[model samples]
Target: MELACAFLARNRMEEYELLRVFFDSKVVREGLSELQIPSPLGRDVGGFQEQWAGPLCLDGILAGLIVNGGAYKRYRGPARDAKVLAGAAVEALTQNRFEDFRVDVSHVAWAPWFANVAWDHTYILTDTANAEITVLCITDTD
Candidate 1:
């Protein structure tokens, strides 16, 4: 896996297809080298974003490496603020009978960091540092 990663970094973008052929079958199905077929424009570019370090190394490697997972980056949040004990509250917050709700966010925190709050109702986040909250409704069940 490390060699595959280094090869990607060392080779030209035009050569990615070659590497795809050598990857595991599961990887191929999950949009590794080729795109799906039989529909609108056939498919889209689905594979590693070369610039993102996380997916690049953690994709096939790091299953049991490092601590739990192989994470190689910097986190600069207050230690306590990063700890989230609000899974139940978060689930309740996005619960919907007619919608498949999901939390498409990270680095999230409630207004009062490390303090107890009714996560089921509301929580403040630093998305964009001073961003507006946007709610999206899904119409598909994939």
Candidate 2:
């Protein structure tokens, strides 16, 4: 896996640390490159801002989508692709019914850092239903 770390939201430090433990584990590290944790979007009951990260694939087949306001430009993809993934992430956060869901972005080939061959994109989303935390992952495949 790449030794790079993406920028995380300062206000969400505690939540980011918890997520870091999971993303940095041996199991998750096997296939993921980098993990990004997004900041809170706005104020609403049960309407917490979406939290997401770009998880680069170890094989260089999956590039991560950059979260808005993130400071890590080195790990960001094209603006168009980023926007699309961001939109999908937001949708996942709003329309999620189950505790976990997957958003498909196979049509997007650009990695957060650079262009790569077309590969299946599956963003794994876990909703804690606490309105305070949500987990997201962008991978090469489901």
Residue-level lDDT of model 1, residues 1-142, one tens digit each, is 3343344445443364422332223543354222222122211122322223322222122122112221234335443333332322333333321122112211212112212221211111111221222221111111
Candidate 2 TM-score versus the reference: 0.25
Clash number by candidate, in order: 0, 3
What's the lDDT for candidate 1? 0.26
Residue 21 in candidate 1 has what lDDT?
31
In candidate 1, residue 130 scores what lDDT?
Answer: 19
Cα deviation of 57 in candidate 2 (Å)?
A: 27
| Model 2 residue 109 distance off true place after TM-score fit, in angstroms | 21
- Candidate 2: worst-modelled 10 consecutive residues by lDDT: 1-10
Candidate lDDT values, in order? 0.26, 0.35
Residue pairs clashing in model 1 are none
> Per-prediction TM-score, please?
0.21, 0.25
